[model samples]
Target: MSLDKRKQAFINLGHFLNQFNSNGIVKKENVLHNDLFFDAFKMQIKRAEEYNSWFTQNNVLFALESWTNALHHQNIYEWLKDYTIAKDSSKTIAIIMAGNIPLVGFHDFLCVAITGNKVLAKLSSNDKYFIPLIAKYLEYIEPSFKGKFMFTEEKLQDFDGVIATGSNNTARYFDYYFGKHPHIIRQSRNAVAVLDGTETHEQLEALSDDIFRYYGLGCRSISKIFVPEDYDFDKLFKAVYKHKDILKYTKYVNNYDYNKAVYLMSLFDMKENGFLMIKEDTSYASPIATLFYESYTDLEILKEKLNNDSDKIQCISTELNIADSVKLGQTQAPKLWNYADNVDTVKFLLEL
Candidate 1:
């Protein structure tokens, strides 16, 4: 496709999306309704059970809206002008998908798909079916892209640019293997929060979504809490405890048990329940189904520390007065433009 044609293709896709009424699909797909995009969210929630928890019907709506808005904001069609791979149709991009969360590899997939590069995707064991089904929907939108994407189990080599998502430990292996090659490696990360006394009972209850949503498996979930020294922890606990129904997820409870026992064995004085934990620390993010608390005196110092610790942090959700340089989240659900894992995806792929 010509550059103009490619740009128009995206623009046309956006327009089509606006007109794309999926009410029937939403009902057929069994997407439960919520306040956010009542129709679209239902479709996405239906898609959630197929793979990574993050890519569900609920988030897909949010993802598409956010991703689409971001594209418009960044003028991605123009940014992609120079990166279009027309003559190099044979160039293949290898994507090692992460099953830790839903569609964690999706933005990278979009990079390849929208840029017209062939994608050789390696499915995570946990999310083997999610992407393909969504891709099937794409086939209806762009029939030409059908053969351009592939799901694979074999090891990848000789790909132009690799995008791999994995743990901090596995990142070392990816670095040694594909690091020298042109690639973007997303290592493990966790998000945290800096809380002031300004939070209300309602805000605190909503904050529970930030912690327990997806059973605390997502990278965006708050793993730790930072508070003022004189702040009352009881109020925070009381607020979060109101949403105790979230603890019913069997898998979440299992993780809480595993972590709580480990804490007890190590002599850590902490409170635990079926789905959440309260640990004391100067940390921003914690492990699954766990939360760490720390006292901060100065917001500026905490901001510096958070910026310094950006690699370990995915996002900082707070009522604190944070600079615009840092990303902010009020509750659990992220806004459309909030990039995952704090990575500059367009820049990363454009460089590739």
Candidate 2:
């Protein structure tokens, strides 16, 4: 299939997704394949929530909107213009997906299809439905996509390259098994925010979205923050208070209660409003409903430390002009070109 046909299929998928919003589902007239997919997709979204308690309706809608925003003609063109994509390769690329957030591995699937390579995907059990539904949608739109994609629950085999996302422990296993093949083995990485005392309330509220969205499961979620030595938690707490409804989710509430009790028992100094907790710690990966914070004395020193530990960081959210930092609140809304772990996935496929 031509790249334009592949791109158009995704754009059509985006249009189908555009109808869903936080308020409610509203089907639009003349959407391609709506008669076939609209109601089925809604049922799948419901199934997603039942399958994983963390996959709430609002979060699923947010993920759909993010993809809708990304799958535009201009965005697709801009992302691929820099790459010299191979047009005639039958290379099969195996992808082992992570189900931390909804459709988290869609980018890799899209990249392989767009680069004229076949994708052999082993779907994570936690996210077994959504992507396959999308693959069916694409196949319906562009029939040529039928042979270009395959999903497996069994072990992956017969692929030229591999892209695997998992925790640090699984990365070691990935290296041992797929070491000889060209591969992109991703390990756990957490995002962080650097706060100056001068940030407006609006920016801090946006930061709260970064911290709380997806129940803090995504790697791009802000699990930690760096603030000035004498920084006051008053403003931060006030801004984040708007998202207190997250506490209503039973899994998050359970985590918050359990972690809070453990912290208190350990006699750690921590601050909590009703829903969220912030503790002073050195770790980047915080537990659910809890955010780790650290105080820095020198901006230059902090910058050097973050830069040195780049591999451990997925993204840095800040209003300050730090190198390679994402703006506050835009961490989850990554552009099509924002490759995970700062690894150029399209480039990897093209070379393969």
Candidate 3:
């Protein structure tokens, strides 16, 4: 489809969503505030609340806005202007989505749809309904897409390019099996926070949202804490303690117990409340029962180390960009123009 046609379809999808909201087909939750363009997203969040707290309470507005904008900004014909796909319409591609957080699969959906390929999508059992709604809308807009997009529990092979998402362990299986095929494989990842100890208690408290949000399930959640040496643990705990009610969730308590047990066996000293755990470590990622706290002296030096280890680090959140501060907790979720995985997606698509 042409860019103008695709944009029109996107607007139509947005209108369809608003129309759904108008007819009361979806329920309203705290996160489901009536955004004019992203009403379907509110419905998706309300549905997700039945399973996950992070999706229920925080309302990841970005997830909704990003999908609509990604579609609107997409230029299907332009993205395919350079690359070549098999001229055969029968060619199919397999897509395996992640249930880690809301709508992480949308990126791959946009990729295949805009490329005009037959999509053999295996929806994550965790996210069974939401994307199918979008797909249904797309079929409504372009009837030819009906046979082109499908959902299945079956494995797929003999395709053009395969895109699969899973944990670091499963990625190896994807690699060994689909390695020779053209593909983009995404593996497990986590984000981190760098604290200079100069931040106000209020900012630190808000930062807690970035940490415990979604129960630290999103790749963007802060699982690690890096700080200046001599950082005050009392103050740090005080800042996070403001969100003490997060402990009320039974699942989080179970995760806390499981992780604390593992730590005890590993001989790591730690303290935990009902939901949150604090421990000392140099790593950037931590388990649900614990948060890794590391001390540093120089922001520049820390930035250098982060730069050296950029492959392992997803984002670096700090109050100020001291020297090489890479803003943390703001990874993966890109701005309207920010491309997926920090690659210029528009350029990639255009050059396809």
- Give the best candidate by TM-score: 2
What TM-scores do the predictions have?
Answer: 0.77, 0.98, 0.78
lDDT of 1 by residue, 1-352 (tens): 3434434445544443332232222222222112223444345457566544434444444444444444452465445545434522556888988876555666677667766677889988876654675565456445576687788787786588888888888888888998777778888778777887778877677677677655667777778888888887677778777658756555556777788889989999876654567889765557677889887898889899888888888777766567533323343444334556656555555456
Compared with the true structure, what per-residue lDDT tens digits does model 3 show for residues 22-116? 22444334312235324554556566767655454344444554454444435434444555543324457788888777777876776666555
Report clash pairs, candidate 1. 44-56, 44-57, 44-58, 45-57, 45-58, 48-56, 52-102, 54-102, 55-102
| lDDT preference between candidates 1 and 3, better one | 3
User: Which residue pairs in candidate 3 collide?
Assistant: 54-214, 79-349, 83-352, 316-327, 316-328, 317-328
Candidate lDDT values, in order: 0.64, 0.91, 0.65
As a whole number from 0 to 100, the lDDT of residue 152 in candidate 1 is: 76
Q: What's the candidate order when arranged by decreasing lDDT? A: 2, 3, 1
- Give the alpha carbon lDDT tens digit for every residue of 1-352 in model 2: 7777777888888888898766678999989989999998899887788998888889998898898889877899898888876554789999999999999999999888888899899988889899888889888988888888899988889999999999999999999999999999999999999998999999999999999999999999999999999898999999999998886788999999999999999999999997999999999999998999999999999999999989999999999989999889999989988999999998999887
Worst 10 residues of 2 by lDDT: 80-89
Best by lDDT: 2
Clash number by candidate, in order: 9, 0, 6
Question: Which parts of model 3 are misplaced by more than 4 Å?
Answer: 14-92, 142-144, 264-267, 271-274, 322-333, 336-352
Q: lDDT for model 3, please.
A: 0.65
Error (Å) of candidate 2 at residue 57 is 0.4
lDDT of 3 at 108: 74
Tell me, what's the RMSD of every candidate? 5.7, 0.9, 5.5
